[model samples]
Target: MSTANESATANPTVLHFSADNDIADIYRAHLPPGWSLDALSAAPDEAEKLRKVRRADALFLTETPLTRDHLAVAERLRLIQRQGVGYDTVDLDAVRARGIPLAICPHGTPTAVAEHAILLMLAAGRHIVRLHEDITVHGRWPKWDYRSRTLGLDGATIGIVGFGRIGQEVARRLLAFGSDVLVYRAPGRPPLERSWPRDRVRTCPTLNDLFAAVDIVTLHCPLTPENRGFVNRTLLERMKPEAILVNTARGALVNEDDLVAALRERCLAGAGLDTLTVEPPPADHPLFSLPNVVLTPHMAAGTRQAHIIKAQAMFENVRRVWNGEEPLHRVV
Candidate 1:
């Protein structure tokens, strides 16, 4: 309940932008006493909110962005700590232009995301989504003539697009399932030098080769400008007709319309997506009608464990900034 100016012991004020009340509470608890905490339902835009009133010394931004316009008015803003690993929402170029420090909680959501990817893969492969829908929409349904389908993880090649922390964790998990893992990271960046399980993974020379080789392709890369629509018609066409695709990464990485077309034409077996170009897509979206596609409302990193881990990491970054020390996960 303590407001910003009332506590004189803490000179600089800190504002947290999180819609979730529980997340705000955890952040507040970790902040040093006397440093004020203000929760906003959304990211601020106008100068008055960012500059005059909130007086944010450091910002903990959630889903919404901290754009150049937003940062322009925050004169005292020294650090922008992201709650999640992805920094797409934050304007990194502007932050770097202003010489402001930015940090991300990479360790927070990797495990949850990896687990969710595996869950989606299983759900799509076993026809769990369609079976459940049939049970609820009509009644308990019996097996159809096409029920002989089975997707075993053993001996299957799981292709991972990126070799970041989350991708590495996915590789580790899939290895335990007796699966061969193929990677398409920048060449010469071998995993053995970094202590990762290189024995279980083979590096593909290019994305095209990776797509042609694997039984299942799981995306773990960021949706940068270069890779925004990476999984378009051509890439999807190269995938084995019976191959599966999994995405716990950014939604924009896959072109929705193209994916829908591929599914309709049976170019690929199915897709399991934890994200879409739009969150909570309209009820009438075409993806809803596709029994071959399994969709989730961007909950790849929404686990309880992930929540605690992200909150802790965010606060630790704040603590380091508050104490005039270097932050652990500086991204910019």
Candidate 2:
């Protein structure tokens, strides 16, 4: 990670302390005229560096863990702006203790992640990987046999776990494909009749109900300590034998070991994962050997359009905090 500081008048500084410099540039370009922007590279003494720059009004954080010690020195810090939707890496408890706002770019992520989830569903359902390998690698022509195993979205019952921005977007697209959408969110929330007709979209009271009923399930929830490994063997067993599982959300939400076992035993038909319990997983990871799994390097929100939108929202929230207004998408 590298760092750069942009000087602009005597305005409060916004620290760009993330691994990606491109994100810093985005912040620099969009921030209001007088606000200062500073980029800090990841280092062994990162906490010490934060101590030195105790006047940062906001932090655009990615991958770097904001420990309690770092927060103690950041007396002037008003907001911690996550570059993307997930804040699993940040110490939320400490952030709240300081009364600082923690905001995410929710608007920027929905379209890209939702589209990726649908893409994965189609790829896994159609056995695209295997068919491509058969033709391109083995020189086999026209692998029509794959068609028998392929599943279609039309008339399929799709369950979206977590009815937030990303989940709702996934539901919208699936509806156009003529799929029945079932959503499972926390209890006590109002029905989603406003977004979709009550007759068209059914609500599942629990994960078990959703898993048992849907032909395909996509995860769009954030990863938190309480929900870590929520999709374990017992819940997975409830899914239909031919059902496809798609996850564009955090990897730790699902038990990767159990997922592999389910796939190996043929209890589950297929899985499309953009994230893993461990990113850049080891070469010998079991999922890599499975023929029924499709994997991407957690790039569900990596679209160019998403990046620009995310950057804009990230700094906009910072500007909001500076202007003494409540930030958008405040998680803490």
Candidate 3:
């Protein structure tokens, strides 16, 4: 990936905060001929630099939270293309008030994230992390007491909070394990896609019902103001005592403080998380102290293949916006 700043062209300027230079290079290559690309640092101190160069025609945004103040400075900016699926960090209201279309590369994330969610589920169910630490770090051998704590996926009922692309993919894999799948979709939405055998999967009427009935519950829903902290004390309380929780979606979807309390009280068996409310959370984050929780940095969609696919979709949308055509995955 070339880092040298290319000469400006006659075409419109597309500004991006180069958090991942390799992905940035992919974006640059896919852009239409004559389009010019400019890079900015994703750090807060560099935001002023972004404001000074406010003539960008479009933005390829990463995880940096774009506030109303930031948008106010970019007077000519017309589109915001997110490289990944989650948009909770970007201020949608500000974008909509400006009439700038906001889009995401949803086509690129499902498979990798779904696979990660399953990995978390299996690891939590089997206590993989704790067992590895027990043997390698403490030099303890496997014993019958440790074996009694582990749970198997087979014959267990699994509940998926949101039946989107990733959730459906998870259901497909769980079925192969001989697990019963239950799904809950937001109100007024259509039924699960017909391709997934309807008889093999059942739909729950409400989140409460789903939580109470399943042996494991996984969240794949996007985080929004209305649904922020959707997995709270009340929902966690409703879950079966032996049930495990897995989250591969946005971290804010589960209230961290509440989750900590649940683990402390053993209200739930365990949790497997690939994201948290804050990235690189404080060194003393409570989740770190719990033996029953397995945490991974937010890398569910970080696979090489997913990156290529996401970059392609992101630039394709950018090309459409540049051509004054409707974007393929408009979210706002």
What C-alpha lDDT values do all the predictions have? 0.79, 0.83, 0.82
- TM-score for candidate 2: 0.89
Any runs in candidate 3 off by more than 4 Å, and if so which? 1-9, 18-20, 25-35, 42-55, 143-145
Question: Candidate 1 on 212-270: residue-level lDDT in tens?
Answer: 89989999988789889889999899998888999999999999899999989988899
Q: Write the per-residue lDDT of candidate 2 for residues 231-257, one digit (tens) a residue.
A: 989888998898999999989999999
lDDT of 3 by residue, 1-332 (tens): 11112222245678775553676777677666777787765553655555633877778777767878778777767678887777877877888887888888886689899889989998998999988998999999776656766878899999998988888888988999888999999999897677777777999999999999999999988887899999999999998888899999888999999999998898899999999998978999999999999999998888878887876776677666666678878889
Winner on TM-score (1 vs 2): 2
The true-versus-predicted C-alpha distance at residue 88 of model 1, in Å, is: 1.7
Residue 49 local lDDT, model 1: 52
How good is model 3 by TM-score?
A: 0.88
How many clashes in each candidate?
0, 1, 0
Error of 1 at 263 (Å): 0.6
Off by over 4 Å in 1: 1-12, 29-33, 42-53, 143-147, 191-199
What number of backbone clashes does candidate 1 have, counting pairs of residues 3 or more apart or in separate chains? 0
